[model samples]
Target: MLIWLFLAMNFIITEVVKGIKHLYNEEVAESLISIQDTRKEFEGQATIVVFPIVRFSKKSPEQTANDLGAYLVDNLKEVTAFNVVKGFLNLSIANDYWLDLFNNSLLQPDFGVIPSNGRKVMVEYSSPNTNKPLHLGHVRNNLLGYSVSELLKADGAEVYKVNLVNDRGIHICKSMLAWQKWGNGETPESSGLKGDHLVGKYYVIFDKEYKKEIEALKAEGQTEDEAKKNAPLIKAAQAMLLAWEAGDEAVIDLWKTMNGWVYEGFAISYKNLGVDFDKFYYESNTYLLGKDTVEEGLAKGVFFKKEDGSVWIDLTADGLDQKLVLRADGTSVYITQDLGTAQMKYDDFKMNESIYVVGNEQDYHFKVLFLILDKLGKSWAKGLYHLSYGMVDLPSGKMKSREGTVVDADDLIAEMVATAKQKTEALGKVDHFSEEERETLYYNIGMGALKYFLLKVEPKKRLLFDPAESIDFQGNTGPFIQYTHARIKSLLLKADYTPGVFIDNQVALSETELDMIILLAKYPSEISAAAKTFSPASLANYIYEVAKMFNKFYHEIPPIVKEEDEQLKRLRLSLSDVTAGILKSGMRILGIEVPERM
Candidate 1:
C-alpha cells in the first residue's frame, strides 16, 4: 500500500518542478534531500528575469535583491537576474505564475507526494501488556506510531503498521493472580468498571497485599529480600505459573477471563483513537521463536554456551557489553523475540526499513538488539530504527504506576471529551448543533486537542502532560486549529461557496497569504522529513503554523461582510479554502479529526 504512494509522490514532485521550470523559465541547479530537511537549487535561464520573491538574508540583501530583480525585469542581467541569498533564493515569476500554482495546488490529487522508488517501511508501536489499562504513556506511543505510519504512507512508501503484544510474562501474571484471588466471580458487567481498569485495580490491590505479606515475613525475622522472595503472593504466582505451564484448568481459565477483559478494553481504546494494526503478534505464542536462530548463531560461532547451559553473545567488540540470548532453561527473552520478529517481518514484507516505536528508556535494548541482528548476518538489521520517544512526565515528576500517579487513557480521553462538551455549552455552541452532532463534535475536538498536544513537540524531548492546561482551546492547540477549520466551514456555508471555484483571479497576496502559501508548500517536505525521522510532531507543528497564519489572515481579511471589496473578499475566501484543505490534510497526518463544528 505504501510502496506505491512514494512513487506517486516522486512523480508529482517531478511534474511540479517541471511545471515550475516551464512557468518561470528557470533550470534547477540541484536538489538536496535529508532525513529532516530539503532544498532545491535553481538558476534563472531567461535574459530578462523576474525578481527574487523570498530572501533568507537580512534587509540589506533582501533590499538589494529586490531592487536588482525589479531593475533587471527588462534591463541589465534580465535573463539571469535572481541571486541566492544565504540559501533561500526566491525567484519571482510573473503574477500569472502564482495563479498557476494556486490552480495546480488545488487541482492535483497528489499535489505534495514525492514519487516513490519502491521503498517499504514497517512501523511497530503500542506494544501494550494485558496486565493493565493503557496510560498516557501508551497514548504518546500510539499517536507517534500511527502518525509516523500515516506520514510514511503520505510520502508514498509502502508502510506496514505492526504491533507486538506482551501477552505473556510475570507482569501479566500479576493481574491474573490478583483476579483469581479477589475477583470472586465479579465480571466487568457486574463490577460496572471498564475491563482493563478493573483488572488494573486488582493489579494495584495485589501489590498492596503483597507488601503486607512481605512485612509479615520480615516480622518473622527474615531479611527484606528474603521476605520478598518468600511472600505468599510471589510464591502463589510461581506456583500458578507452574500450573499454567502444565495446562492446569483452573489457572488457564482465570488467565482467559482476565486477558479477555484487557483485550476488550484495548479494542475500545484503539477504536476511539483511530489506531489499527496491519499485524498483531503475541509473546505467548512467539516468545521462543528465536531459539532456532540462537542455535544457528551458536553453530556459526557467533554465540557461545555458558557452563550453566545458557547462550550468551559477546558484543564488547561492537562497543556493547556481553548479553544473554537464552537462559539456562532455554527460554527466550525480550530481545530474542524481537530478533525473530525482525527476521519474520523482513521475510514477510522484504521491508527496507523497520521502525520500533518504543520508549527512550529502551535505547540500550534496541542498541543491543540491532547489533546482534547485524552480527547474525541479517543485512536488513542496519535498517532497524529505534524510534525512541521520551516518556510523558507530569508536573509532579515522573508517573509511577505503583504509586498510583499514572493517568488512565480511557479516563483521560473521557475527561477531555467532557471538558470539550462543557466548553461547547458555555459558548452556547451546542444550541446550533444537533444532539448527535454535538457529541461527535466533542469527540473530534477532544481527541484532536489531546493528540495535538502530544505531537506538537519533538519526539526525543520529554512531554509535560498537564491535563488542565493541555485541554485549553484558546491557544496553540488542536482545538484551536479545529476552530479555524470550523470557522471556515461556517463561512462557506454562510456564503454558499463551492469547492473548486475561483471567483477572482486577482489574488492580491498579502504577507499573511504569501506566508500561508509558503507554509502550505512546506507540507510535502515536512511529511517526508517527519516520515524519515519517525516524528509526528513535525506534521503537528506544520498544521499549527497554518492555523496561526489563517487566524491572522481571518482577522485582517474578512471573507464575508457587507460592502466588503468583492474581488478581495473572493480571493480571501479562496485562500481560506486552500488553508482549510491544508489543515485537514495535515491533521489527518497526525491522526486527528477536524470537526466541521467545534
Candidate 2:
C-alpha cells in the first residue's frame, strides 16, 4: 500500500513537472533555476503563478498538502505565484523545480528530525490506588501517558516514564478492614478468581455490607440521617483507622494482606499493557516525608500556621482558594504528599520539567502545588505541569464502585484477549499457526484495539466507553489498522521482494496511491507535533489516517499484477516495509501491539 502511494506521489510530481514545462516552454529550465532569485523574471511576467492546495487551520490533510505545495514552490523560484484564498492556497511548481526537491527529500538524512528537534519531556501516569484493581480510567491514563512519552522520544528528546502508587489512605484501609471481617482463609486460587479481581470483590463486599448495616439501623426506628452517620459499620471502619494510625499490629497486618493483593493485580495489568516505569514512588513511603518540608516553609514564612495548629497557604493572591497543607493533628493531606514527591523527584533527576498526568478534578490542587513551590523559591516550579485529562464515563453512567459498575482492568484485558481468540478462530486462520504463535498474535491485536480506542481521543476530552462500538474490527478502529498491517505483511511474503535495493524501472501512480505515500512521509512531522503538544491522540489520529489511506490504495492498486521489473516491485515493497515499521513503533508508544495476522 505504501509503495503504491509513493509511486502515485512520484507520478503526481511527474505530472506537475510536465505542467511546469508546458507553462514555461523553452525557458522552463532557466526559469526553474532562476526562480531561486526572487528578483528574476519568468517569461515577461514578474511572478510565476503557482496553485497550492487548500488547508484548514486545525492541521487537516488538506492543510498539510497545501503547506507542502507552498514550501516547494517558494524554494524553487523567486516571485512564485502563491497567495492564500480564504484558507486554501494554490501554488505551482515547475517540472524542473520538483525534480530537485524530490531528490533532496529522498536523500535527506534522518528526514524531518533535524528541523523539528525540541526539548526533553517526561510524562508520569498510571498512579493506581492499592485499595482496588485498576479500571477503565487507568487504561486511558496509561495509554495517553505512554503514547506521549514515546512521541517525545521519537522527536529527539530524552523521555522518562514514571508511576506513583497511592499505597496509603483511608480508602485502602477500608479494603483491609473488609478483608479481615469477611475473608476467611480462602485464597485467589481457591476462589478461582484473578488475584486483583478477588481483592476488588472483597472491597465491593465491604461497601455493600457497610451500606446494608446502615439501612438495618434505619429500619430499627432510627432516623435515616442519624443511621447513615452513626452506623456500626462506619464506626468500626473509623476505629480500625485509628488503630492503624496508632501502630496497632492487628490493623497493620490486615492492611498488608489486601494491599499486597491489589499490588499484585496491578503488576499483572501493567505487564499485559507492556508498561514500565523508570521510577516508582509509593505514597505511603512519601506521605510523612513532607512534614519537614512544610515545617521549613512555615519558618521561611512561605506558609502560615493557622490558629488550630494546622498549616495553610494563602492562594487567594494567586486567584485560588487557600489550601490546608496539614491538619490540626499534623497529619499529611493529599497535597502535602505531592509536595514531598515533587521535591524528591527533582532532587533525584534535576529534570528541567516534571509532568503529573492526573485527572482534571485535581486542577485546583496542582495549581496550588506549583504556586506553593514557587513561594518556596524553587526555580523549577515553573516547569511543573499537570497534564489533567478528563474522566472516563461509561455509556450507562459514570463508573460507581458502590453500584458495582466499575470495569475491572484485569477483567477487561482478559475479555479483549478472549474476544480476539474467538475472532481468530472464526476466521479459521488459527489452525495454520502454532498455538503459541496464534495466542500471541491474538493478544496483540485485541490489546492494541483496546488501547488505541482509548488513546485516539484527546486527553482533555471526556471519554465514553461504548464497549461494543469501541471494539469494532472495521472502520476507524485499532483492529482495522492491524488488519492493514497484516495485509501488507501477507503481500510482502507473497511478493518475495527485498527492500533497500534501488530499482531502475519507473511506474505511474494513481491519485489514491500518491495520497498514501504523502501521508506516510509525513509521519516524522506528525510525531514531532504530537510530542511538542504532549498530545498522543494527534499521533493516534495520524496513524489511523495512514491505515485508512493505505487500505484505500490497496483496494485500488494490485501490487502483484502486471508489475514488470523485480527492482520496481522491491522498491514498492520497501515503502510498505517502512510504513509497517512506523505503525508498529507508534502503536508501541500507546502500549498497543500489531499482530502479523488478525
Candidate 3:
C-alpha cells in the first residue's frame, strides 16, 4: 500500500539530488534530499527541504529554494509548477498524476492494509473479578485491547485476543459470605436481575454492613486501624477464603455457583460491547501453576527460601525490593500465578509477543514481573509488554466498586444507545425506516460513539467521557464520521457510480477537490503510523480529517449528478467512493461501524 505513495516521494528526492548536482557541481546523496507534504498555505502537493542542500549551493536559503524550484519545473513533467517559502521548495504535481492515482490506487478495497507477515501476537484484557459486574474501567480496557489487536492484525500480524478471569480470592469471598448471611437464597431467576449484578449487590451489601461493624468497634474505644483488623465480617470473609482453598465441598460449591453467575453476566456485557476473547484463563485454575515454576527457580538458584519457608527473589541490587513468589504456608502470591501464566501462554502459542492491557496502577507490578521473567532466563521475556492506560473518570468523579457508584458497563451501553436514539431522531431521517433497521442503526452509532470517544485519545491519558458530547454529528465525533460515510454513499447511489472508470483528459480541479485527494492519499500512512505506535487515536483523527475534507469538497464543488461534463462527474463520483471506502476501513480498525444510511 505504501509503495505507490513512496514512489512519488522517491521521484521528487531523486530529482532534487540531480538538481543539486547539476547546479552546484556536487553529487548529493538521496538521503540528504528530504521531502514532505507541502503546507496547506503553499500551492503545491509536496515540499523539499532546501536547507539541507544549502551547503552544496553555497547560497542563502531563499536563493537555494529558487535555484532548485527552477530546475525541477523545467526538467520533470510530473512537476508542473513550483513555489518557494524561505528554504522550502514546494513542487506541484500535474493533475494527471492525482487522477491516475485516484483511478488505479485509492479505490482498491484493501488499499491501506499491510500484507500478512505471519507474526503471532496475544493481547490479554478485561481481566475482571467475579465478585462484581464489569464497569466503565473494564469498558475502556476492553476497547483498547480489542482495537490494538485489530491494529496489529492490520499491521500483518496473526493476533489472538484473550481474557484472564480473577474469579477467586478475598474479594470473591466477601460476596459469598454476604450472600450466605442474608435471609433467603436469591438467584438471578428469583431476583429478575443479571447474575453478575445479583452477586455485585451482595458485594456492596457486604461493604455496607462491614463498615457498620468497623464503626461499632471503633466506638468501643478501639483505634480505627485496630477496629478494621478486628472486624468480625472481615475475619469471616478471611475464613471463607481459607475454607475455599481447602476444597471444602460446601464452600467450593458456593464459590463455583457465584463465579458461574458472574461469567454469564460478563458474556452478555462483552457481547453488547462488541468485544470477545479467543480464550479465557481463570485464576482459580491458574493460581497454583507457579509452585512448580517456583520449585524450578529455587533449583536454579534464581529464587531463595526465607527462614519461614517463603520463596522470594531478592532484587534490591536490581533497584527493586525483594518480591515474594510463594508464602510461608505454601500459598501463591499474585506475581506467582502471573509468572506461571506468562510461561504457560508462551508454551501454548510460542507467539512472538504478548501484551497485557492493564491499567496504569499496575505499572510497577508488570515491571517487576517482566524483570523476574527475564532474570529466569526466559527467551520470550523481552517480547512481553504492558499496555498500561489511565483510569476513566465520569463527570461526577472517580468510581468506587464497594460503594457501588461505578458506571456499570451494561448500563452505560444501554444509556449510550438511548442517547443515540434521541439524538438521531432529532434529525428526523428514520421516519421511513422500520423498527429493526432503526434499532440496528442506533446500536451501531451508539457503540461507535462510545468506542470512538474512549479510543480517540492516547491510552496513557485519562479522559472524562461525556456521552452527550460524543454523539454529535457536526464535530470530531463518531456520528459525524458515520454521517459523512452515509452521505458519500448517498451521493454515489444518486450518481450511479461506474467502476474502473478513468479520467483521460485534463480537467479543472477545485481547491477543495485537490485537498480531498491529498488527504485521501494519506490513508496508508495513517494506518502504518497507528499500527507502529499501537495508537488508534492517530487513525481515528486521520479519518476525521478525511471526512472533514470530503464535506468541504461536497459543499464547495458543483453537485456531481448535475454536472454536464461526463469525465469530471466520473472523477468526482470516484473520489466520493474512495473516500467512503477509506473512512470505512479506518473506522473498522477502531472497531467502529459506518452505516450506509443516516
In Å, residue 33's CA in model 3 sits off its true spot by: 3.8
**Native-vs-model 3 lDDT?**
0.87
> Order of all candidates by lDDT, from best down to worst?
3, 1, 2
Model 1, residue 225: distance off in Å is 1.4
Return the lDDT, model 3, position 2: 23
Give the winner by TM-score: 1 or 2: 1
TM-score of each: 0.86, 0.82, 0.95
Error of 2 at 435 (Å): 1.1
Q: Residue-wise lDDT of candidate 2 within 1-598, one digit each (tens)?
A: 1121222134334433454444333223322221111122222111222323111122543444345445545544522455433333344324333223323453243444434245545668899887777888888888777777777777777767888887776676667767777888666678886666777777788789888987898889888889877887777778887887788998788677767776777788898877878988887678777887798799899899978999998888778888899999998888888888888888877777778889999888888898899999888999889988999999999998878798877778888888888887888866879878988988887887788888888989999999887667777778888888888888787777565454342444444544444466667767767776788888888888878777776676665534686544554675577667667777776767787765
List lDDT for all candidates, in order. Answer: 0.76, 0.70, 0.87
In model 3, what are the clashing residue pairs, if there are any?
A: none
Candidate whose TM-score is highest: 3
Any idea what lDDT model 2 has? 0.70
**How would you order the candidates by TM-score, starting with the best?**
3, 1, 2
> After superposition, which runs of candidate 3 have C-alpha atoms over 4 Å from their true positions?
1-7, 18-32, 471-473
Residue-pair clash count for candidate 2: 16
